[model samples]
Target chain A: MRRGIGFWTGLGFTLLISAFLILPVLASVIAGVTANQFVGLSSGLTTRWLVEVWANYGGTVLLSLRIALATLAVTLLIGIPAAYVLARHAGVTARLVEEALVMPVAVPGIATALGLILAYGAVGDLRASWLFILAGHVVFCLPFMLRSVLAVLLALDLKGLEEAARACGASWPQRFLGVVLPNVSGGVLAGSLMVVTLSLGEFNMTLLLHTPFTRTLPVGLADAYTALRTEMASAYTLIFFVLIVPLLSAMQWAASRAERLGR
Target chain B: MSVAIRLAGCGRTWPGGSIALHPLDLDIAAGETLVLLGPSGCGKTTLLRLIAGLEAPDAGGRVFFDGEDVTRLPIERRHVGMVFQSYALFPNMDVAGNIGYGLRVRGVARAAARRRVDEMLAMMRLDGLGGRRIEALSGGQRQRVALARAIAPRPRVLLLDEPLSALDARLREQLRQEIDALLRSLGITAVYVTHDQAEAMALGDRIAAMEKGRIAQIGTGRDLYHRPANDFVAGFVGDTNRLATPEGERLVRPEHLALRRSATGGFTVVQATFLGPVVRVLLRDAAGRELRADVPDEDVPAPGERVAVLFQGRSLETEAAASPA
Candidate 1:
């Protein structure tokens, strides 16, 4: 009887926790679709706000895609080698390197953003441009890319695969292209997706270092909020939300597949 | 087909006080299987890796392949085939792709590579398994795929690092014979690493026993079994009952002992055990010093039974100093 009661309590707690987390998103979706606009509430299911934001608000969408792709390419080039060294090397030096890579992840994103702004903002001679925005995105996305790829790299059986390739007369580059790359491709995809997501959602760094011409999606969205463009801002948020939800879901799906693959 | 690989003072010491291998000289001959048999951490794997050029020896040491110094060459240029303890099949590739990896890397045309892969697949008895992903393969299947990959390019040398250690006993025994036959048929100079004495004796044409970063002894299985070089080698190569004589030492194989029906001399049977075809009798002297003997089942002795035993006087006792050289 006591076991049955305990089971019921646990199940109830899980349901309530899930509901608590999901309720706000559900409410926002209903509000987004149903709220009365200046055009007509009787047509109620109108997408006028989405159309207005897409047409007149800003070029936030384009900026977000650009930053995300650049971050993806740069992060992969840096993260793969960092992960390989950490995973393959043994002893104190490798451990120290691993911890150093993880240090930025332990730091708050706001701290990094502020530090960049101070260094490159009014005090530094460099003017804020798309270049500065990309630089910030790279810094912000580095930890995420490294962590995800490193996890996969560590989980792999390096001696097994590398030895097999070496024995098969595979040159180092061939081994990298054929054996190492294929095994780590899933991790790369997942890490690249993560970098893109982080770049797209970055608000703090974008706001601090953004120029009028170089504003990212999140920064533009915040500017819209300050100017009393709540409805249009909400529409922009919905579009951003639409783009992000799929990406995040895909990431979750990939993560679960990685788990099932058992590395 | 004849070849000889000479290791002229090969050595390697990783950072942080781990001595992976000590400077050593040895020769490996073509169409011969040399098993480096030792306990874990005894540098057996390190020796195989060094020979394969996966790891370089210390600056002064050199590795010679077929009379050519290949120590500085990269692993690919060395053209050595290696099978790891883990199967190491490429997870992303189908069985065919994994098998054809070496051929493709050697710049074989894609169509020709595929044909070679098919031939290797059939050779390894993996005909229909070509399209399956590595993840879909069973342990034995994966191991065979790895074997096929290693043999596909017909490398001059084959190195196996504890190849059968991962399999169950029955499978290990079965595959040991298969791999032995395969290596012999290919006429390749092979170095097999394992701590299993049974495996070493069963597969190695000559076995090099190692301990604590040095070779303990190198001999044919029968030679090492009957005439081990030292106390460590006697204990490691196979089971033995060792006794200290007024001289250096005397070791006797359990089976070499002859158990008589009566205590005609100073020996007495303390215990007896039936072990299928043979009966193992534990003998002792007046000083409670213990010894063991293995005789045919019909000559079985009971506990507390008195027995006469004799020692054979053939041994390479002076050969101890020359070992581990």
Candidate 2:
């Protein structure tokens, strides 16, 4: 088929915007492997900067992974049931509660972290432990998990399915485990990916909440950029993308699979 | 095994005081198939849910299963099988998994559950399709899976709520016959709910015709057709024409009314519609009251012809007197 001028113009515009968005990330990736970012590609590529980054920030990376996984676990435990209740009630009260839960996401992360610190900082143990950082991550990541699960629940005939299960002699736990959980697997997958990725890269909130010993990857990345060589910071950025891209792709696959099953 | 059911003053009211079902008494003998037939929002589904233990009746109401009071029993303990209009099959499970879900939940062994699921698969004529996902099945096939799943656990009573309303007309008729045969072979007490009158007449051993949250009448198809207790049942069960008789207002079936051509008659034929088996002749009397008569195709009067209308049946008593007219 022959293309029209409008189609070509739109294509050009989209490509231009994509390049505009991706060019900096591409430069950072190239700089991560380059011998010296100041001299650009002519300086040649090497893995020394990546090795240096691992040697210096490996603890921060592991801490971020631990915090992200813990955040994922905490949010799933609390967010799923909260979403289920909200979806079932679905009245004025549910709307109010949902709005309140989403308030942290709507507010600036720094302000939310400040509020959390003020509320719990009086307790010396909580203020010093990595769990203090985990608490902030849970609050920040919960809305994503809840919203994803709630979307799936709202789309489903949950009451009808539950009644059918009940009529089949299944107990409440059986229905939840057998029917509700499996039906919402795609939503859970999508939410888990978002929570993990966001929690791993979260800087503003983590910076406010973290003790020196509890420094996360993004906080460490910021510190590396300010206090270390440019190539090392770029290597850290490259590492972050490497860790998150596969998870994002898995989420995409789950979304498409969900759409197919829905059809 | 089949079980008799009794609803003593069972009714339902929503949280805001809106009545969904008025308090009413009902009884179903073992192995009887009772159809609760009504239009949308007429409380037929609500009554069925009460019997299935999915809904609690209002205060002072009670439900019984085989002489045992189960009013407070939840659906999980009631052990009644239910089929919904949407088929409500678990999307995550294949046909065999869905059919065996109830048995599995009841602590049946995996091997036994598989055997029963296979038996149900064959019974529903879905022998080789047990491994197929729900999305892969046709509408009729999905309904079959749903039915198979509902009945696999051998519940005491079976409840179906507009189970065939979602299928196409040809499929609906075929499945309706299959359901009738299944109900008879199983000999399980079944409470079916639907808005379709033809379905009610075909499958119901006794049809409870409801209107505005109350049962207008309950009887066999013949009784409801020939001797409706009220005008609501009369008009709802079948097509009827209300005639202004000197004895008082009378309801007559269209088939029972005879139309004959005559000059200077009180009735004029306004429209003649040919409907293959019968020609429906519509007439307007001098009082501007419309009446319909289904006559043979060969003797159908043309439009604008004056005709004399004769009543073939006696006037039915108007006990309630407040018909939907």
Candidate 3:
């Protein structure tokens, strides 16, 4: 297709905005590799800050991974079947239930976290555990998973497919496992990525919910930023990027591949 | 092994207290294709669903397969095959995977399932296309895959819910003929549903013309054309025009009505549509009683021309026309 001058102008403007957004992150990555942030790269590159960040905050990184996976598992377990059920009914009741599920996402994260603490804070074991923060993450992440899968289920010819499966003599388990899951794989993948991403990066709710012992990566990064040096904080950011980028890249590739495969 | 199906007072009612199909008894003979014919919302599909075990009949109702009571059996236990108009082929699976899904779920061994899938592909003229994805195939091919998948399980009864309605006119006709042959060759008791009267006529051994929530009439195409039990069946199964005969008003077809240009005739040609083999002419008399006649294109009178109408060939008095007066 031929493009007019307007397209070139738009491309230039977009590039300018991208550079503005990306230049800071690039500078941080460079600072992380430098021996000293004040002297910049001429001070000579070294892995000491990166190593220091890993040693000081490695447990938090591991805890964050655990939280993300736990949150994802909970969402998938409840969300997929919930989506199917809600998709099938599609009445006012179902809509009401969906909106209710999404209420946590719509409200302030800290408010939701405060509600959780008020309800469960009486139990000392529950309040101090990473599971408390995990609960907050699940509440925030589940709606994304449910809505993603629900949208796909609603868009599909789910009734026809179910009827066809039943008429083919397939048991309920067989139909769900073989037919429903494979057809909705794209949605499930997208939802999983969103759940994990949100759980990992979630700050405000996690901030209020987490105890010092249950510190997640983002909380640790904030601590490092406030109390530590620029080089160390920049190295912590680099570690965060290292932990998240490959996962994001893998999910993006999988989604594109699934798109190429027909629904 | 096809089995006779019987629905004894089988009916469906929604949770909202709306009746989709009123309690009615129906018997379908083994190896016969009984089509449920009606316009949408006439409960034809509801009846088919009742037979397929997808919908249970209301209280005091029962379904029997080959004289064995199967009213309580769900569709999986009933072991029936069904094809939908949308050709609901599993998009994730290739053609062969979709066809063999039934057999695989039924516990057929991998090798045996492959052999059966191959046989079904050949039977449906889908050879070498098994590796193709469902989305890769054209509409007709997808429908053929749907048919192959349904029949692969060797179901005792096959249910097709307007399977060919999604295709273009030419493809629909071609596939219709192929399906007719397939049903005949399989000899499995099948209940087909469609709103198209012509399709119902072409494929049904017996057509059940439904109206509202009940079967208005059930007979062969010829029987329906000649002897509709009521006005609904008469109008639905085929075009039937009212004729004011000497004895009383009677139903007639456009082909049976003869139109001739007459200077003194009270009927005026309202419109003449040339439809290739025949020209459909609409005429209205002084009383505004409209009559339609199909004639050769050469005999078409211009619009507003006066014409006389006469019933020929076989009128209401014909031996086959035994419908109640």
List RMSD in Å for every model shown: 4.1, 2.7, 2.4
Candidate 2 positional error at B311, Å: 2.1
What is the per-residue lDDT of model 1 for residues A1-263, given as tens digits with 9 covering 90 to 100? 35788898999999999999988766555445545745544647757767887886448788788888888888889988888777888779988877776675667767877787777766454555677788788887887777777778778887678777877887778888777766777788778877888899888767777777787888878876788766667778888888888877876787668644533
Computed on alpha carbons, the lDDT of every model, listed in order, comes to: 0.81, 0.91, 0.90
Of candidates 3 and 2, the better by TM-score: 3
In candidate 1, list every pair of residues with a backbone clash. Answer: none
Arrange candidates by DockQ, descending.
3, 2, 1
Q: Name the runs in model 1 displaced over 4 angstroms.
A: A1-16, A33-43, A122-126, A246-263, B16-20, B243-249, B263-265, B312-325
> Residue-wise lDDT of candidate 3 within B37-155, one digit each (tens)?
99999999999888888888899899999999999999988999999888888888899989998998899999999999999999999999989988899999999999999999999
**Regions more than 4 Å wrong, model 3:** A251-263, B317-325
Q: How accurate is candidate 3 locally (lDDT)?
A: 0.90
lDDT of 1 at A218: 87
TM-score, prediction 1:
0.88
TM-score for all predictions? Answer: 0.88, 0.95, 0.95
lDDT of 1 by residue, B200-307 (tens): 999999999999889988999887877777778877876677555556556677887787777566677788888887788898988888998888888577777777
Residue A165 displacement in candidate 2 (angstroms): 0.8
User: Chain B of candidate 3 versus the native chain B: what TM-score?
Assistant: 0.96
Sort candidate 1 into its docking category.
medium
